[model samples]
Structure formats: C-alpha cells, structure tokens
Target: MVVHALHIRPSRPGAWLLGLLALLLMLPAKTPAVEGVEGELRGAHRWSGEVLLSGPVLLSEGASLEIAAGTRVRALAPESSLRVQGVLRVLGTAQAPVVFATPQGWHGLLFERPELPQILRHARFSGAAAAIHAQAAQLVLEAVVFEGCDLALKALREARLEIQGGRFEGNRVGVDLELKSFAEIRDVHFVDNAEAALLATGGCRLNISDCLFQGNGKALSLLQKISGTIHANRFVGNDGALVATRLGAGLDVSGNFFEGNRVALASNTFSQPLVVDNRFVKNETAIASDQFSTGEFRHNLFQGNQSALINTRRADPLVTRNVFERNQVAIFCDFASYPQVRENNFFGNQMAVKLGTYQSAAGARPPGAQREAQAGANGPGPAPTFAEERPLQDFVDVSANWWGADTDLLASLDEQGNSPIFFDRRDEAEVKSQDAFAAGGPIDWVRFRPWLIAPVADAGPR
Candidate 1:
C-alpha cells in the first residue's frame, strides 16, 4: 500500500469555499416539480410545492387530500373552487406556511360532510368569495390569515367550526354564521372589515373570546335569535361595535373593552341580550336601543362617553350596578321607554337621566286610517309584553341611585320632596299611572326617588 499524506487548510478563502461545496454535496436537493390539481380526486392524493388549479376541483366521497408545508396554490379563474365532499388536511409548519392565493376572484374552498373532521393550520387565504365555506362540516382552523375576501369564512347549516389564532382583515365580513351554525372563535384579530367582523343570523350560536376587533364597521352583528357568549374582547375604532336585532336573546356579553366607536352597542326590534362587566371609553353613544328591545345592563363602566344609554320606543332595559362617569348624558329614555334604573352611580355627568317623548308626524299615515299605522314615533306597535300595559310597559323606576350628595343638585333636576315624579306633556298633570293607556301609548313618569347618598364602589371587569 502506498502511504498518502492528508492535506488540511486553515484560515483561507479558497478553503472555506471548498468546505461549503462539500457541505452542499452532502445535503439533499429540493424538489422542483409543481403538481397541477384539477378535475376530480377520488383517491388519496398528496400535494406539495407550487400548485396551479387549472380548473374547478372536486374531492369526492372516500377521497382524502393532504397539502404539505411550503405549498402555494393559485386559483386560475373566478369560478374555480375546491369542493371537498371528503376530507382535507393541510399540514403546514409555522416557518413554511401554505398559501391559497386568488389573483382575481374565486369561489374559495367549500367543505361538506358533517361527520368528517378537517384541519387547516398555518394557512393564508386571500381574495376569494369567502376564504373557507363550510356547510354542515366539522372544521378546525388555526393560525390562518384571511385577507381581501368578500367574506373571510362562512359557516352555515349546522356546521361546527373551531377557529383559533387567526387574522381577518380587509374583507367585507370576517366571519358569517347562519342556519344554526355553532362556532367557537378565540384569539382572533379582526381589522378593517367593511361591513361587520362577526355576523350571526338564523339562530346561530357563537362563543367568541379573547379577540381584537379594530377599525371595522361593525364588530359584532346579531340577527334572528342569535345567542352566545362574547367575552374578553377589545373593540376599538368601529362604527358600531355590537348590534343586535330581531328577537336576539340569551346573549352574555361581558369583560369587553370598547373605545372610540360611533356607537358601542345598538339593539333593535325586541332583542334582549345580557350585557355586563364591560368598559366603555370615549364612544359617541355607549348603548342605543329602540323598537321594544330590552336587556339586562349591569356592572358596566361608562367613562368619557357622549351619552351612556338611549332607550327609545318602549325599550325597557334593566340597568343596575353601573358606573357612569364624565358623560354628557347618563341615560335618555324617549318614546315610552320604561327602564328599571337602580343601584347605579352617576358621577360628573351633565345629566343623570332625561325622560320624555317627542311627538312627530313625519312618517305618519293619514289622520284616521287606523292609528296602528302611526303607533310610535320610531316604529310600529311594540312587541306584545307580559306587563299590565302593553304600550307603556311600566314606570321609569329611578330608585336607589347615587347622584352625589348635593340635595341642591337633585332639586335642580326638578325633584320634589324625596321623590320626583314627572308627567308626560300629552297627559293631564293629575295622572300618575299609565296602566290604562292603549297598546302604543306614551309614558308618564320619571320617578326619581329613594336615592342613595353615597357613590357605589367602582367594581367591574376591566
């Protein structure tokens, strides 16, 4: 055997280059071929690298599709959609996320099959009809970014979706829930959606928590008996942060921070939601309700708002244990609203409460063509109530409230003796009860009595 000497070089540019070349030779080469997916998939298929959807794709029953990390799927046209009647699994790492890009517009991904579970994690979807549309499916999406879409995600027809740790921005709507859809959305950032961030209708149930709603038109919009819990969310710089209508009930809204909104909450048309432990700061109107909408408003902090609450058209909310500080108007009741205002602290507000009705005939019908046509100033007849009076439901009970210690200030609010009773301008001065009035009559009193001498403790969720 011939003896061979081993040569080693140290601290030289040419040696470093050679060492790098050797290391490159030891590494595996990356795959370059991009798979094109289209038409129908009936068997299990795996996709990786840059994928181009040549046409609409359908994953039929008993088929499974898996997308690997660092994959980019681009839609070719507006009508292209991925309809999965089977199962889809997108397995993407945090560093190498999967992207579904729509250069123009597309129909987006649609999922069927309620029993099959679908998982999408570390995915980015952009510019489609809706980024993901799930109908009666069980889907879980995590760390997904949806941007510039008509709607970010739509869940319909009794679907169960768990969306966690996502970002929704620059869309018409962030999430749309309809037809008894049940969703649990948490730790999402929704920003600058044009219409609403989260919209639920048609008896949907949603549990939204730990989310941030910023610069959207409406942060939350509920219609048609939507019920859920919304907690620990931040709503900032929206037009109307939360809006409910059409008999929405059984909602628990708590531990929210609202700031710089045109209206923080707007309830209409018999919607009754429980709102508690929320903090409102610098909003134009903290809460505005009309058309017989009523709710339990308790333990809320209203600070630096233009107006705290405005209840109109027989909207009789139960207001209790709230702190209203430095507001222009604490509460304004009009058009026969009968709020049960008790155990609240009103400090540094221009006016604690104003109770009256303004008669208007702008939208009124002809003089004698059925008084039902011109029932209330804001709308038609109130929703039938269980109370004694159907129209003027009850007295405006302003009792056991802290309005500072100055009796002189209380007198300036038109108080008499220990209890101040107000009369409607339309009614005779002698009448105290409005119980005998018709179904859509005006209210008669702002009974300000049995007041508290000291301020209530500042205790509520922040």
Candidate 2:
C-alpha cells in the first residue's frame, strides 16, 4: 500500500526559471549546418563551415582569414578562387549574412597585398569573375552584394576602396576603376550593368554620392584622367548616360537625373566636366560636345531632347543657366564650337538655333590633336577626325537668351523675309565683348545680342 510521494515545491524558484525561458522562446529556431571546406589557407584561418571553394585558394603571406556569420561560400567553377595576400576579416551580420556563391563562374575575391584594412561586413557576392578584386589592398565594403559579375568590383593598382551599402546587379562592368583607384561610392545601387555602371580609367578617384544608375550600359565611363564627384545621381534607362572620354577631367556632375538616354551626356578627347544641376529628360542627345570637349553647363534642364546641344570638335562649352525645352534642335553649333551661350532658356524649340555651315560644319579638330595620325607636322589629325565632321564656327554667342521670339522678332526672321526664326547675326556685338577668344572665321555668323523680354523664370522646367 506504499503510495508514491512526489514532493514538488510550489514556490517560485525564479518562477521555474521563467517557465523554462518561455519554453525556450516558443522553440522553433534551428540553424546549424556547417560542413564544407576545401584546401589551402595557411597561418591563422578561422571559418565557420560550408565553404567549398574547390580550387585556387591561396592566402599565404603571414596569412589570416576569418569568416563567420551564417557562412556559405560555394565556388566551384572552371577555376574557383579566393586569392588574398593575407588578412581578410568578414564577420558578416545583417542577420548573419556572408554568402559568396557561384553556379559555374568563379575567380573572385582577390585582394592582393592586404595586411590590414580589409573588412567586408554582411557580404554576398555571386557568380563571379570579379566580384571583388583589389590590387593594392585596403578595402571596407559594408552591406555589400554584387550579383552576376564579370566586373562587379575591380579595383586595380593603388586600391583603397570604401563602398558602403552596395548592390551592383547583373554586372558586366559595375565598378572597374583601373590604375590609381581610390573609390568612396556611397549608398550605391548600379542596376543592370551591361557595360558602364562606372568604368573609370587610369587615374581613378571617384567619390560618387547617393548613387542609383539604372539599366546601365553607360551610366558613367570617364576614361583616362578620371577625377570624379558625380553627386546626387539617378541616371535612368542608360545607353549613353555619361561618357567623358580621354583626359576625363575633374568632374563635378551635380544633381543628376538624365532620363531615357541615348546620349545623356557625352564629351570626348579632352573631357572637362562640371555639368551642374542636371535634369535632361527623354534624351536622344542632351549634350554631346565632341572632340576637344570642354564643360561647365550650369543649371541644366533640357526637356524632351532630340538634340539639345551638339557642339562638335573644339567643343568649348560654357552654356550657362540652361533650360532648352521641347527640343528639336536647341543649339547644335557645329565644329569650331566655342559655346559661351549665356542665360539660356529657348522654349518650344522647333529650331531655336542651328548655325551649321562651315561646309555644313563638322570637321575641325585642332585643339592639340592626337587620336592617331602622327606623320610629320600633325597632318592627318585635324582632318575632321569625326567630331560629327566639325564646322559650325559662324560666330555663335547668343547672349542673354530667351528666344521664344523678340530681338526684333529674331532679326525679322533672319534672311530678312524667311521669318520662322533664323539668325546669321542679330543685334551684333561681334567678337570683342563676350570675352573674345577668336578662331571664328568663315564669314563669322551668330551674335544674337541682348534678347530676353521674358521667360527665364529660373531657367528650368519650361
């Protein structure tokens, strides 16, 4: 008759350990699958499972590699890689992220002389060829994610990156600043990169701000002497979003938003950028400026462009306070271009200005030549090396513009009786007042003086 005496104390023993920690926080959390690794990683390496790189994995040079948080690196291609010349510390944790995938395209993550300063937090590089390849190491990529790469990130020579909040998708050339690297691209998001999401050359030194270059094919391609500052970016539907060629000088492209491009901003040869307050919508040619390219197009905004500024070789731009709406041709000055067209605002353009005819313009390259053609006396270099052929030097100054009509109705419709808006030389001031710098010959045309009885109203949006 011995009854079972179960003595259970009913007193709070810290409430039964807080009810067993709320039943282990309502249990249902299991993440423990780490068993995958492949050879080679000398001296001080610390990994946390699932990392089958299956091939090239060198890291020796007083080595030191460390990857933890939810790691899952699988790179098994025709030539998998991990390179690194020593020291890589990734403790990713944006809810424990640290993936570096590959389906059959790997050869990425290759920092060269890294001894320190290599932190890639919350990383996620995919199918690579260059998901990350620094040369003279010193990286710091936070919240990163460069998908389907071919050149998602290629910082050559003197690398010193610092890309924060990255996300360069479907790459072909997302970020490939060559030679002298020094990036600092913030809040990045270069989508659909098929060519130039950012291809800065030789002397790279970008400082791109709040970026977002969508549908990229040429969202930025400053070559040669690249010195950047692409601020407030948003270059949409690319195809020619930004092209600054050769000597790509100190850019400062401010407040950008050049939409639907086919040629949003293109400079050539001596690319000297500074294009400010940009906003060229529906572009087909919102600024071309060829060959001896020069820039400083202030307060820009050329709507519905079909041609809102072409300027050929000798492209000396300075067109200030811009706003050339409804473009069919807002200003196409041919070669020998010396654009200083001030206070612009030519509305509803069906042809607000053309000035082509130095043999019908396009064939005037003499701003220091050099696109191959060096025999004796720089002969072949100036024969219209193709800046649309070059030849609009018929004087063009177009002062204090407003041009919707007024200036004796555009000099009584230039050609005296052809009145639909023309101009060979209206209210003349010839080459002596607008800080003349001559070269304008061939019967010099286009002077367009003190015009503007209205419509400038802050030079943009009509």
Return the top candidate by TM-score: 1
Which whole-number lDDT from 0 to 100 does residue 199 have in model 2?
Answer: 83
Compared with the true structure, what per-residue lDDT tens digits does model 1 show for residues 1-462? 333333548756588677666666666677764655689999898889888887889999889999999888887786778999988999887999999877656888989763689999999988888778899999999999999998889989999989999799999999998999999999999999999998889989889999999999999988899888999999999999998998557989999999999999998999898999999999999999898788999999999999889987668789988988888878887655667888888777876666554321111112232343345434766633333322222346687888764434565664433222223332422323332233333434456666787777753443
TM-scores for every predicted model? 0.82, 0.42
Residue by residue across 1-462, what tens digits does model 2's lDDT show? 233333445684666666666667667665554434455678897777566766777887778989998788776663767888888898888888988767646777788877688898988886677777888888998878888778778888888889888688888888877898889888888888898788878888888888888888888887888886888778888888888888556878888788888888888887888888878888889888877787688888888888888887567778877888788887876545777887777777777776555312223434444343343236734343334445444456676788764456665543424334443333222332221222333424665666777767777522
* Root-mean-square deviation per candidate: 6.8, 13.6
Candidate 2: worst-modelled 10 consecutive residues by lDDT: 429-438
- Between which residue pairs do clashes occur in model 1? none
Clash pairs detected, candidate 2: 334-392, 335-391, 335-392, 361-391, 362-389, 362-390, 362-391, 363-389, 363-390, 394-445
lDDT of 2 at 404: 69
Q: Candidate 2, residue 248: CA error in Å?
A: 11
Model 1 misplaced stretches (Cα beyond 4 Å): 1-28, 356-395, 405-408, 411-445, 458-462
